[model samples]
Structures are given as structure tokens and as C-alpha cells.
Target: MNAETASPILAPPLITFDRVSRHFGGAQGVTALDDVSLSIRRGEMVAIVGASGSGKSTLMNILGCLDRPSGGRLLIDGQDVSALDTDALAALRNRRFGFVFQRYNLLHGLSAAENVEMPAIYAGRPAEERRRAAHRLLGRLGLQDRAGHRPSELSGGQQQRVSIARALVNDADIILADEPTGALDEAAGAEVLALLDALHAEGRTIIIVTHDPTVAAHAGRRIRIRDGRVVADEGDDRRGSPATAEAAPCRPGRSGPVRLLGDVASAGRMAFRSLAINPLRTLLTLLGVVIGVASVIAMLAIGDGGREATLRRIAEMGTNLITVRAGAPGIRSLADLTSLTIGDIEALSEIRGLAAISPERNLRTTLRVGNRDYTTMAQGVWPDLLVARSRQLAAGSFFTRDDIRSYAAVMVLGQSVADILFPGQDPIGRQVLAGRVPFEVIGVLAPRGVSGGGTDQDDVVLIPLSSGFMRLLGRSHVSSVTLKVADAGDMERVADEIDRILFDRHHIRNYQIRSSTAAQIIMSDSQRSFALLLGAVAAISLVVGGIGVMNIMLVGVTERTREIGIRMATGARRRDVLIQFNVEAIAVCGLGGVIGVGLGLGSAVWLRRLGFDVLITPMPAVMAFSCAFLTGLVFGWLPARKAAGMDPVRALAAG
Candidate 1:
């Protein structure tokens, strides 16, 4: 029926539902609302009455803009609402309608004034203006004395009254009440009905959906629905005459542009307060993240230190030196040569770019001084071996060219060997037995610490190569050849040349040549593999941490469902609801990441003090931060979406 057939038109209808039907699930699903048609004019008080399962609540949902009609044209202030998407619909709901529910739907942790101010906050109202509007509305609703009370502290009727003030705070043109008196006792319900009557008297457009005939009697017009269709429309005498009145002019409220900013600030404050209240949970959450970060940092630091030390030791051994030992291909093993003769040394010296060449040979033998005998490594080399091999003599003198020519029985002992043979006495002039052969102790080499392979260099005796070969262990072949290249840059080329020369001399083909670069490559590959393995392990821990964040956020959403319903019922758009919860999740994760970084750095320092080389590089820190932030954003999506996509009616019904 048209407006003229029912009653004389005063102002344009604020809302109209034309042949609307909504269904759930697939094509065979049940219909929630079917072929419902109605119109509501500005400054009109209408009641939708029905028993349970009469489609009354579904109609209310459409009117409040909570759901879109599956079929039909629905209009609000001449705008076809059925054509809007989810975001546009939410925007229209926020800007054009106000809702009051039966259970009050107040945010449990917020004060009465804050609850009222929520709509203005979502409308982007400035803080001071929102405060002033909230205060004015609360005062108008007679809640000024109860502004600081939380929902739990207020009576049912008072809570509903606070919700009404929140609805009106946005100064919306239409007020939709869905079972507003349902949870109240007779006395409280009567007070709420009277309040609605008063607002209608002030020329506000009000729609109330209720099952009680007494509540419906207060409306200017009554529409009764059954089985998803409106069956009756009747005018009530108590609502005054419709024809004699002029339309009330719409007045725009003050700008609320900063409302969203205020809401963000408030949500942040609440998050901080919650964290402070549950200190133990917060600390425990941070602990998991902290340990993961600390392990990563310490491992890196130690690896870095070890790499540096190795490089330093390589430099000290002299980059110009090239050593050749007899070993299987790809494996380093000592050669079993009887001697490296003067002829072999001369042959190596003839190679181009060779600075020096020395024949090195060693034997495991016992040295006897008086009654004491000690087992030691007896090495034989050229007079220039000290300079060629980077050895330093600490006492007396190293063997000279004359000593080599004379085949002298004089020996230069390493620091460890000297200590054992001489004890506290000077052995420079004393003679010692080398495998029962008399040999004079002439010099002692300085102590050299252990190598990377854990071998001590200061446990040997040095004698002239000629004397070691002719007098002690008489054989022709040398153990190995040690060469000093003229130029360090030519080491690779010279090593190749040497390999060729030795292979030609021995009549062997395909001999492998080892170099420092090969050793470096092996070490680098090992480190990279180890680092990747450790990083994968760390990533797993991060995933667990992310899951923890998601679980907690889901719980938060469940606990705050009523709060979400209240905000949506006011003027909050779905995005506002989504953002508030998302921000809270991100704040929690970000805070945990920062604490983790601090702990990681501290752990690295502690490891360094314990003599483990660790390198906590900036890359890990950046990666850790990114992981934490992204964990919050990615995992928080499901819970935040659940909160945002909630049906306001169902949410309020939850309590």
C-alpha cells in the first residue's frame, strides 16, 4: 500500500522495504524473511509485533542495515540499499541509523560515558567534541551521575538507558530497537517504554520490534508479521494525529572527523592496561621469543670469532709458504719418505719464481741425556729452514751451511724438547744421544701454540739435513719439499708448476695439488650449510610463536564479542572493528619482538665473555623483527575478521 492510502504523508519515508526476501545456505535453504514490505516515515513511531519464529527479528535486521535482503529492493532515504556491498552497507549503517538492543551490549571494561562516546569516536569526532557530546547525551538520558560506572555495575534498565544514550549520541535520524525491553523486569521495561514514548513525543523517528502487545500499543502504527510476511497494519490512537503536524527539520550534528583516532588511542590504552594487569602471561610470552633470538645471536657470534682466528693463524704462518706432503687425493696425510736429498732441493730451486727451497724430513726417535730418555719428533732441514718455515730460535744458534756441509752432530731443539732433555740445566754445550748417536744441543726454538688441528709445534728437534740423512737415518729420498714463492700473488701458478715438476720427476701422472684457497672454500661451504640449518630451526620457533599470538587474539575476540556488538550498533563500520582488534594483536607481537631483541643481544655478550665466538649480525635482527610483525598481521587476520564480520544481532543475543 502507498503512503497516501494508509495515512496522509508528512515527510518522505526514511526507510522502505519492498517485497524483500532473505535466505540462508543454498537454494534449498530455509527462508528467514519472505516478501516483506513496509514503510517508515520521519518522526513516526512504528512497532513490529510477532511471536517467536515469526520473521519479526529478520525484518528488524534488514531495517537496522545489519544484513542485505537476498531478494527485493530496500531503500533508506531514497538510496537503494540492496545494491551496496559489505563495506558500503556498513558505511551507510554507521552514518544513517542507530540501534538499541535488549541486553544493553555495553563494553564491559569501559565506563558508561566511554560507551556512549563510542559512536562519536567511530564517526571521527575530535576528542573534546566527542566528550562534550557524550556528556550531553548521558545527561539527557539521566545517566550523568552514572557516567563512570561500567556495565557490570549498572542495573539492567540503567544499562539499557546508557545504550540508548549511545545510540542518540550520533544524532541519527532513525532509531531501531530490537527487543529493547526483553532482558528487563516489568518495572525496568516500563521505564524503557516510557522513555521511547518521550523520544517519540520529541518528534524522533523510532522503530521497536517486540512480542509484547503492550509494548506495541505505544507506537503510532502497528505492523504484525507471521511466517516472514506482514499480515496487518493498524493505526493507534495513543500516538496522536498524523495529519496536523509539520515535518521536523533535520539538523546536522558537529563534525566527528577524529572519532576513529580517539578510538585507536583508547584501544591502545586498553591494550597497555591489559598487559600490565597480566604481567606473568606477558613475561612468559616474551620468554619464548627471547630464547629463540638469543640462540641465533650466540651461534652467529661464535662462528664469526672462529673464522677470524683461523684467518689470523693462516696469515701468521706466512702466505708466501707452500708445503707439499705425500697423501691420497683429497685427503691430507704425512709422506713416508726416507730423505729429501740435496739433488731434490736443487731440482726444486731451479723452478721459476721460487724464492727458497728446503727439503724437510722427520723421524720418531728417542733422545737420551745421561740416564733420561724421551721420545720426540726429530726433523732434518736446510740451514735456511728457520727463515723458510717461519720458525724463531730462542737460544744459541740454528744450524749453519757449514754445519750442513760438515755433517755435524749438532741439533737445535724445540722449546718442549729442550725442556725434557735438559730439565733446568743449560744443554747448549752438552751432548745428547739421538738413537744412541752422540749429538750436541746447540739451539732451542721458541714456543709456538697449538694449531687449529690441536697439534703442538714446540715438540721437535732440528738438525742439518745432510747430518740427519748420513749419520742418523741413512736414506736417499726426502719426506716432503717446502717452498717459499718469490711473489705471494703467484702462489697458485707456482704451486701448479711445482706439482708438474714433482710429477715429472717421479714419473707419476694426475697428482693432486692442495692450496690455501681450497681449504678456505671447504670451510666457507661448511659454515653456509650450518647457518642455513640453524636458520630453518629458528623459523620453526617463530611459527610456534605466531600460533601463540593467533590463539590469544581469538580468545580476546570471543571475550569482547559484546563490546564489538555495541560498537557496531552505535556507528562503527566493519573496518573500524577490524582495525581495533588487529592493532591490539600487532601491539602484542611487536612488544614481544623488541624484548626478544634485547635479550638476544645480552645473550651474545655473555657468550663472548665465555670465550665462544659469536656474531649477532644486523641481518638476523631485521629478520626477527619482520617475522614478529608479519606474524601478527598474518595470524591476526582470522580473529579480527571474525570480530568484524559478526552479526550485531547475534552478537548482542550471545549475552
Candidate 2:
């Protein structure tokens, strides 16, 4: 190859069109650009003059990468536009095309400087660099003083100038101005035209789309477009095939981690500013998420608390223990006593693996202490119960073996019974009459408030077995036999043995013998399933909240359709728009999550104060917050995609 041929000193044309066509509908639809072939060399100042319905605007849309050609391929600096995805196309526009429009298209929430820094933001420029570039460009454009002012605060001419500064922020290679001075007065319009002339003189490719002859005169070359066709051209029409042309080396836009962070920051700021536009609506939307998350956490907390309490109760009753009732549940009165007798209990106590037995019988009668008459429940139990049931003595010693054998009329009052019978005095030696039978109070059991089964644990009296059966109740058979087995693993075997011994002795089919451990397992499993069901119901709120977010975002996309188009025309990638909307949704959900966690915890505390069990673990809150964030992402995607897929020409016209 010749040295000159391989030198790579000469560059391809900056922009090209190969018989490009842009049509709106099917065969009978409007043809915006019909078989338009064009190419502009680097630094050329070309004017595309056309009437309102002409194809100049359509050509501009294609050149800016805001719209695609229907019939032919477009090439930028020898790179086929069709080969790049939506995001890559946006990156190219951000780096190469600077746009100035008649409507200005300045973001209302951003200051002049910030609006000028937008393309740089997409270009992965840091905050400091974007600010520095914006200031420098504003100074050059004679709008330095207006840099901090928003578009609404600036005059029409000032807004137009700020937009020009924005177009130049990334040092874009091509400046596409669509009636740049159409909205300005004669003096202001002349100033903008002169600015364009200066930029053209500095070797920046300038393309101005306009119908006015006065504006067209400022360009070095004029191309007239009529009926979606280029009727005339005054500049180079040379075109190169994109497939064969040497491709220009372009930087992969913002690919590094640092650049990714910068883009995230930009999206965050934009989303936040957009939220500020409708504060009440944002708050309402956030409220939905907060309530949903709080409900989930709170419901789980309550369910877990109840389950834990029940488990503790079951655990308190020794797992190695077994309970045998005379008859099935609901066997209440002594008159309804079953075939169970003291002889049957004595036989069961001899079974292998049997550790100890406590035959309990109860009597309910009006007992008199001093001049006060009160009704109390009395249980006939032995001293062995103190260790077997984990009971503690508050005062005095329990009855010995002699008390049961002699049928002594002595009793030990529960804490609740003592409080009612003795009041502020000691009950260790007090005599209380039970159903006209006098009984001596020997000791007081310490308070055991309430059991897991909702039974009042502190409201009974314990006396000797002989006293309750012979003296108090005057019954022959015992109430129930509770046995403690030697090995926890043998509890099941011992329960079956008791059932077999009782069935043979009583010659009755009605009886029940159960292991507390089995009951614990059944209770735990049932409670767990219930908690899960409750959580699932609460989770429905999260779904509803996510739907609300999607609805709001969809409305936002509709309301800001024009703004999205403006950004697209100014070199924003489709991903940039998508990220911006997603950022907004996530921000809402994240903030709501924080608030919801606090609310859930506070609610738990309040419920506990009201005597309800509430277990507040970090897992539920974390899971709820995570779900809320994911909800935003899932729901926000549709609106973001819709915004990204919009047609720039149609959007701008709607605005």
C-alpha cells in the first residue's frame, strides 16, 4: 500500500444519508422524508429550508438520532447507525451532536448552568467537570450572569442562549439548530444568528432547519426540501457506502465503574428534582408504600410473638411428662367422674420407664378467712409436685408424707388465693373453712400468673391428696394422673402403656393419654402455618402499592412526554431516560421503607404495652424493605420503557 493511502490523516464525512425515508404509517400514510440522499462534510454550514409540512424536520430527527430511517441506513463518521442499539445511539448523540431549538427545551427544574451540563452528565463527566464546562460555555455565550437562574426565570432570548451553551457543553462536532431564533425578537434573533456564524467559522458543522429566507441567508449553503424530497442542493452530494467506508474510532461511552457511578448520580438528581415538582402526589405515593411495608412487618411480628409465647408455655411443661385424663376433654363435674380409680394409678406407676406420678383432684367451694367469704379452687397434690412441676414455695414448708397418710386438713394457698384470703397478713398457719370444713393454710406458692392455655395458674390452692379426696370433695376416684418418665425418648412408650393398663382395668373405651412433646410439635407447626398465611395476606398490600407506583409513573410519562423528547433531541440515550424514571420510583420506595420500619417498631411497642405479645425481628423489616425496592423496579419498568421508546417528532409536536 502507498504511504499516503495508509496514512489515516484524512477523515470520513461527519454525517451521511443513503436514500433515507421516514414514513408515519402503512402504504397510505404520510411520507416525511422520501428517498433523501445527503452527506455533509466536516465543518460545513448547511441550511435546510422547507415549508411547515416539508421534510427538513424529519431529516433533523434522523441526524440527531432521535428517530430512525425507514428505508435506508444512516452513517455517522462512517459508523452505520443501524448497527448500534438504542443506548449506543444515545451515547453517540451525547458525544457528537449539539442541538439548539426554537422552543429552547430547557428543563424547568434545572438552572441554566445545570441544563447546560445535561449532555455532559450523559457523557460521564463528574459534577465538578460538568459545572466547570457549563460555566465556561455560559461565559463564552454571554449568559454567565444567568447561569444560576431556571428557565422560567430567564427571558426568552436568555433561555435560547443558555440552550446554545448546553449544545456546546460536550464540544459536540455537529450543531443542529431547528429555527433557533424563531421565538426571539429581531435584535435577539440577530444575536443568535451571529453566534451560529461564529461557531461555523470555528469549524463546527452547523445544520439549520428553517423556512424563513432571512434565516437561510446566514448559511454558506442552502438546500431546499419540498414534498418530503430534497428539491435542490448547493453543497457537496458525495456519498460513501457505509459497509465499505473506514469506520471512525469512537470511545465506548462511560463504560468504567467511575463513569457508571456518575450516571447514577445524575439520574438520582433528575429523579429527585422531578419529584419536587409534585410534592403532594409524591407524598401520597410514598404513603402507600410505607403503609404496605409497615403492615407486613407488623403482622409478622405479632404472629411470631404469639407463636413464641405458646412455644415457651409448651416447653415449660416438661417434654418428658405425659398427662392422662379420666375421660375426654369437657369432663367437668365430680358427679361425671369416670372409671379411673386410685388402684389404676397404682398399677400404672409400676410400668417400666415410669419415673413418678402425681394424682391430682380438685374441689371448688366457698372458703372463709376471718370475716371474709371467698370461693377458691383447691388441688390435692403431694410434696413431690414442688420439684416435678417446677413450683417454688413463697413461704413456709410443704406437707410431708405424714400429711397425706393422716388425711390432715391443711392447705397451701396460691399467691392469688393468699392475697384474697389473708390480705396483708401471713397465711402460713391461717385456718380457712372450705364448704364448712376447716382447713389450715400451711404455705403459699409463688405467683405463676397465666399458663399458655389461658388457665389462671395463681388462682388455686394445693392441699394433701387425702384431704381433698376424703375431707374436701368426699370423692373416691382421682381427677387425673400426670406421670414423669425417666427418659424423654420413652414418653411415647409410657403413654401407650398407661392407655393399655387403663383400658383393661376400667373396661371402658373412653379415656385419653397424651405426650406433651407431641402436643408441642403439633402446636408449633400449626402456629407457623398461620403466621405464614398472615404474612402472605399482608404482602398483598405491597403488591397494591407497587401497582400504585406504576400508575403514577405512567401518568408522569404522559405529562412529561414533551420533556422526554427534548432530552432525546439533546443527545440523551434511551437508557438515560429509563434510569431517570427508575431512580424516581426506587427513591420513593426506599424512603417509604425507612419510615415503615420505624412505624412498625413503634407499633409493636404500643401493642406490647397493651398486653399483646409482639416479636419484632430485623429479618421481617429487611425482607419488607427489599420487597418494596423490588416492587418499585418491577412496576417502574413499564413507564420507563414507554418513555424511552417514544417518537421525538411526535412528542415535540405534542408539547
Candidate 3:
């Protein structure tokens, strides 16, 4: 038999519509369906024919459970469906009825086999079972070779065939077709009609709705609807006889951890697959999140690194150490240390907590060794200065007190100076010239990376204070005095007492006094404040990225409304769509977060290479990743909720 004729094998009515009515909005809104009552026995081919705007499509929607009636009792076999929830309806659709739409409504990004397996997945079939079923069905349809092809890769007829395969993959007993051939030419339409006819002959009850006369004529019975009402019923009145059959069993309820994980996996696959379809749009959308997360990590790393470096340098000077630089009162250029004689140093040595005091004087001079001259700071300090400033001799001991008592020309070279002037050779007893006087190299100080005040410490030459003041420059002035305190608790009090003593001796308050503890506290507070400010600024970009995600997802929902409808009609619940969108949002931002981590690390390395002390700590990295993920969830919820709340029929109708 062809599609137009049906066997007289009536067993029971598989679907019944009893005075069903559907209204849109309210009494003022349009009436889409009104008082429609009808039934079709099993194994019968029925066609619903009407012009545009007639109630035929509404009737089709109600039968397939894609929509609900405003008022009426609708039954599938013996079960009433009007009181069912959305999830229940979705389950009913998955196992009972398969739909063929006018536009095919196949998801564009999915392959033929994948699209055909959609209903099985919602029905909770195992992956292997779903795969086997897809294979069997594709083979049965004589389209095994085209199973991997996407909708865009197929012709109109092939795509419609794929849709038909998808509808039947769940082995649904009744097939509902809404203008299945409307979009096809004569040849493709004929091919689809032949398949429908073959299914009808196999004892499957079929309902086809169309406005085309030739398509309607192919049915054994024809019901014509007009203006949301049934106007005429022609052919086989006895086919409406009352009969009852058990409704298809619903799948297990959607709950539990396993089901949740499955739901998430499915949603993730769909989300990522859809993203893969339009690569450019996906990449462009990911840009904001990437840049924002990257900025957060990079900025925080730099600020923290700089702060730590600065603090370390300050700490190197000694927390309880204080320095007094000589100067005259009311002098603006106090940076120019005028003079602090040995008398002033001796006067300050009596202060409490004065553990070890080192009076220091420096002169900028050229040191000549073996016909090579190097411009360097020539510092003259007492032996106690080494112990006060945390210095140690690498080769020989520092000069004795006798060297200071007598005007000896013995000199101690800094580690860097030793390396430069006497490379690969012992400099002990080697002679270097300073200010036209030959000095013996007695010792070399150990290397210090970066000095307390942010200068290179290993680039000086040390001599006795007597030698520097007497023989070298004929001067008896100390440029600065560095004092080490006995106890950290009394550092502040000690500093005050020393300042008073220095003021009394030097008779000037204009001199500068630097307390290591005070400088440390100030630098630490400033660095913390600066770090927080940078973090706050970087967080702004994360917010912007989140907003962009929200905006783009909302637009995505609007654009893919029809696809949402198709999924709902096939068996996807509201939460399924919601999860799909949320997963997409998270995936995009999470990937960006990862990339931002790499980008941030790269930036840190580059800054370090540029001579900036940048630190990449774990906390900032953690914060950046957290911000990115949070942005997605916070910004993506509204759009996902909107999509989930949409009516399936209305979504289907959206352009």
C-alpha cells in the first residue's frame, strides 16, 4: 500500500483529543485552538489538512505534547496528559511519539548519526546502546555512508531523511509529521512519501498534517480544520471507534548524582560542539575573559614582586639598625653630608642599646691597579663597622684597630672590586693606588646581592678611617655613622637618644636619621596599599568580561530559539537547556582562565627578564581563576533562566 491508504487493522485509538481548547494570553488574546475532539485507531494513516493559520498545526502540537491545551482532557492511549509537568511531558515525548517538522529542525552542528541518537540519550539509554541503535537505523535507511555528514553537508532530501531517522531511533510507535514535505521539491517529496508509506504498512500508526492536496490525498482518512476549529471530517468515520491501549512507559525520573553527572556531560558536549561550529564567534567571545583574567594575574604579580623586592632591600640594612648622616642645620642640600668628626662619633657611643657603632666616610676616587683605573667609592670605616653592617671577609681579616690608630695605607677591596682588579689571583698584599698613594690590599669583603638602600654593596674599597681622613684627603670628617642596636625592642628609644646626642655634639637638627625599622614599616604599608589598589583595578576587567558573557549569551538564546524548541520537542527538559547554556558560559570562561594563567606567567617572566623583580605567587593565580569562573556563573544565570522559561511552541515559532 502507498502512504495514501491504510490497512483495516484497527486495534485501538493510540491518541485521543476530547474537546481540547488552547488560548493564547487571555480572553483578549488570539484563540489558537477551540473545542477539537477526535481519535484515530492504531495502524491507520490520517491526514490533517488546512490552509495557513488554521488549527491543524495546533492540533499537531497538542498531539505531540510540544504544547498544552488551555482547557480539555487529552489522552495518549489510556493516560491523561493534561496534568503532567514539563519534565513528564518531555519523557512522554521521548518514548511515545517522534515528530517530523516542516523545516526538518535538525541541529546544524550535529552529524546525522548524532542527531539520530538524540532521543535515545534523553531516554537514558546507555551510550553503547545508543550507538548501536544509531548504526542499525542508519543502515536500515540505506544512508549508512551519510551517517557522519552534518545537515549542511546534505541535500534537502537527505536532511529530511536524517530527521526521520532521528524520530524513529527510539522505536516510537506513533509518528507525527507536520508538513513534512512542505520545503522539498517534487522529487525529494516523493522520496519522503515513499518512506512514510512503508512505515504505515508496517503496522505503525501515522498522522500527517499538511495543506497540500496531493499530500493529504495520500491518507486513508482526512480531517480538515479552519480558524482553530474542526470544520469537516471525510473518509472512514468508523476509524474513530473507541479503544484503549497502554501508554508508553516513561523513563526514570531526572534526579540523583549519576543522572546529574550525565546531564552535565550531555550539556557540555552540546555546548562545546555548538561553539566549534562557528570558530570565529567563539574565539571573539573568549577574548574578553582571556584578557581580563590575564590582566588580573599579571598586575598582581608585578605589584607583589616589586613590594617584596623593596622590603627585602630595606631588611638587608638591618631592622634595628639606625644611620645618622652629617649635615648643617637649615641646609636644603642635606643629602650632602658635610662632616661628622670622631668627636661626634665618640659622644654618641655612650647611648644605651649601642651594640656596635661604625663611623663611615666615603670619597669618590679612581683606584689604579696594573695600569687599569676603576672609578669607585672609597670607604674608610673602623673594624667594628664590618660586624655592625653584617659583612664578613672572604679571604683575610678586616684591618685591626692599630691600623686606625696609625695612619696606615692598608686597603680592603669589595668582592666586586677584587674580581675586577685581580681576576683569578689572590689580591692579598697586592698594591693599588688611591689619590697618588700606594695602598696594600689586606682583605676583601663578601658579596652582598643588593644593598639595604637599593645600591650595589660589593663595588667599594675599604681603608682605615685614619688613612682616609689623614693621608688620602687630609680631612677629619665622617660622612655617616651606622649604628647596630643591642635589642630590637629599644631601637626607637635608642634612635631618639642618639639623635639628641648627635644634635648636642653637631649642634644641628637638620641632619637626617634613618631607622631601619621605621623605613621597613613605611615601605611595607605602602607596598600593601599599592598591591590592593592594583588588584581592585584588575578585578574591574573581570566584571567587564562577565558582562560581555551575559550579553552574548542572551543574544545566543534569542538566536537559537528554534533549536531550543526542537530539543524540547525531542525530549529535553527546561533544566536541560538551562544547564546547556550555563555549561557553555563556564566552559568559555574556564578556558580563558587557564589561558590567562599561561599568559600571566609569560608576562611575569618577561618582566623579570627586563630587570624587574616580579614574583608569581600562588594566591594571585588562585584569585584570578576564581574571578573568571565566578564571572561566568554570575553573568550567565539570567540568560539561561530566560531560555529555560520559554514555551516550546512559542520557541518553535520564533524566527
Residue pairs with backbone overlap in model 3: 4-218
Model 3, 45: alpha-carbon shift in Å?
A: 3.6
lDDT computed for candidate 2: 0.81
lDDT of 2 by residue, 36-90 (tens): 8877766667899999989899899888887788889898877789567777777
Top candidate, metric lDDT: 3
Q: How many residue pairs clash in each candidate?
A: 17, 0, 1
**TM values, all candidates:** 0.76, 0.88, 0.84
- Displacement of residue 200 (Cα, Å) in model 3 is 4.1
- Candidate number of the best TM-score: 2
Q: Would you list the C-alpha lDDT of every candidate in the order shown?
A: 0.75, 0.81, 0.83
**Per-residue alpha-carbon lDDT of candidate 1 for residues 1-655, written as tens digits (9 for 90 to 100):** 2223344435666679999998888699878888888877767789999999998888988888777788998997777988887667665666667788877777776789988887777666666787888888888878889999888999999999998888787676578888899999999999999888777766667899999898998887999998888899899423322542333322333344454566668667666755665677666655655655555555555555566666666654545777766543654444453233456467778888877667777888899998999998988888767766677878898878899889999999888888888889887988989997989888888787777788878888988988998877677556666787778688888888877776666665323444655665566567666666666677677778878777876876787677676677665677877777777777777887887777767877887788776666787777777777787788778888999998876676665
Better of 2 and 3 by TM-score: 2
Off by over 4 Å in 2: 1-13, 234-254, 312-321, 327-338, 341-343, 352-356, 386-397, 400-409, 433-440, 449-455, 467-476, 485-489, 503-511, 514-526
The TM-score-based order of candidates, best leading, equals 2, 3, 1
The per-residue C-alpha lDDT of model 2 at residue 618 equals 91
